[model samples]
Target: MDGKKALYYAAIAIAVLIGVGIVISVISALVTLVSTVISAAISLAVLAGIVYVAYKAGSWLLGSDDSPSMDSIGSGSSTSVDAGTSRQDRLRQQYVEGQISEAEFERRIGEELETEEIDDIDRELERER
Candidate 1:
C-alpha cells in the first residue's frame, strides 16, 4: 500500500509539472506574438515618416513651403535644446578639464545621487502630508 501511495504522488507531481510547462509555452507564444505586432507597428510608423519626409522634400523642390519645421521633427522644447549639463556630463567635463580628480568626481556624483534620493523622498513625504 505504501509503494502504491508513493507512485500516486509521483504521478501527481509529473502531471503538475506537465501542466506548468504547457502554461509557460502558451504564455511565451503570446509574448512573442505581442512583440512581433509591436515591432511591425513601429516599422510601419518609421516607413511612413520616411515617405512623408520624401514627399515634403519633393514639394519643397517644386517651390512649396508646406513641410513641417525642424522643431516638429525633434523635441520642440527650447529648454531641452539649451546647454544643460546632466550630472554625468558635468562629472566628465570636470574630469576632462583637470578641475577634479577621478576619485573626487566619483564622490561628488555619489553625493549627488544620495541628495537626489533624499529630495525625492522629501517630495513624496510632502505630497503625502
Candidate 2:
C-alpha cells in the first residue's frame, strides 16, 4: 500500500513537470513570433524611408526652375513677343541655355499650343453664349 502511494505521487509530479514544460515552450514560441514580427516591421519601415528619401532627392535634382506655369500660357503676359516673350520662346531659350532637354522643350511647347487652343475655344464659346 505504501509503494502504491509513492507511485501515485511520482505520477502527479511528472504530470506537473510536463504541463510546466509545455507552458514554457508555448511562451517561448510566442515571444519568438513577436520578435520576428517587430524585426520585419522595422526593416520594412527603414526600406520605405530610404525609398522616400531617394524620391525626394531625385525630384530636387531633376526639377526644372522658373518655368512658366500652365495657367500663364494663354494670358496676355505670356503671349507677348517682345517684353515678356512667348512661352515657346522662353522654352527655346531654356533649351539653348542647356537648362532643359530638347524633348522637354518640345513637350512644353506642345502643351502651350494646346492650352492656347483651349483658351481660344473657351472664348468662342463664351461669345456664342
Candidate 3:
C-alpha cells in the first residue's frame, strides 16, 4: 500500500512539474515573440494584417468562404451542406453522369425521401424545379 501511494504521489509530482514547464515555455516564447515584433522595422500589427489578407485570399482561391473565422461566428448561416441542391437532384445527376446505376439512383432517392432532412421551402422548390 505504501509503495502504491509513493508511486501515485511521484506520478502526480511529475505531472505538476510538466505542467509548470509548459507554462514557463509558453511565457518565454510569448516574451520572445513580443520583443522580436517590437524590435522589427515594421509593426507586428501590420504583420497581422498581412497574415489576415493572405488567409482570406487563400480561402477565396480554395472556394471555401465558410471556413471558421471570427467574422462568421455570430452570423446566421446555412443549415444544410448543399444550400440550393436537393438529394434527389444530386442522385439524378449521378445517374445521368453514369456514376450510379438506375437501380442505385432509385434506392438513393427512396432513402433520401425517407431519411433526409429537408425544409419545407426546399422541398417545394425541388418539386417546382
Candidate 4:
C-alpha cells in the first residue's frame, strides 16, 4: 500500500512537472501558447496512461493493492517467524531465562493461540448435561 501510494504520488509529480514545463516554455515565447498547452496536455495524458498501466500491471502481478504480495514469493502470503524461530521454543526460553513466570508464560501462550477460558458456570452446565 505504501509502495503504491509512493508510486502514484511520483506519477502525479512527474505529470505536473511536465505540464509546468510546457506552460513555462510557452510564456517564455519558446513555443506558441496554444501549441504548448496542447503538447502539455498530451504529455500529461500519456503519463496518466503510463500510471494506469503500471498500476494495473502491479496489481495483477502482485494481487490487491493493499495486500500486494512480495516479489520474492511471486504469490501467496509471507510469514515472518521472528525471522524463523519457533513460538514454543521462544516461550520456553522466556521461561528459562526468567523473563516470565510459569503462570504468566502459560497465560500468554494461551492468549496468543486464542485458547478460550471456560467460565465456571459454563463448566457446570457441561457437567450437568
TM-score of each: 0.49, 0.49, 0.32, 0.28
Better of 1 and 3 by lDDT: 1
lDDT of 4 by residue, 30-120 (tens): 5576788999999999999999999988987777765434553542112332222357678889999999999998987786554223443
lDDT of 2 by residue, 11-129 (tens): 99999999999999999999999999999999999999999889877766687434554666777634443332456788888999999998898898888888777777777797899
Q: Write the per-residue lDDT of candidate 3 for residues 1-129, one digit (tens) a residue.
A: 999999999999999999999999999999999988777846767888999999989988887876655654564334343432456677788899999998888888777765545555566687799
Q: Report the poorest 10 consecutive residues by lDDT, candidate 2.
A: 77-86
Q: TM-score: which is higher, 2 or 4?
A: 2
**Cα RMSD to native, each candidate?**
24.4, 8.6, 17.7, 22.5
Which one is best on lDDT? Answer: 2
Q: How far is candidate 1 from the true structure (C-alpha RMSD, Å)?
A: 24.4
Off by over 4 Å in 2: 64-129
- Tens digits of per-residue lDDT for model 1, 1-129: 999999999999999999999999999999999999999999999999999999888888886775455654674333322322366688889999999998998898788777666766776797799
Clashes of each: 0, 0, 0, 0
True lDDT of residue 11, candidate 3: 100
| lDDT of the candidates, in the order given | 0.79, 0.80, 0.76, 0.72
Which stretches of candidate 3 lie above 4 Å from their native place? 41-129
State the TM-score for model 1.
Answer: 0.49
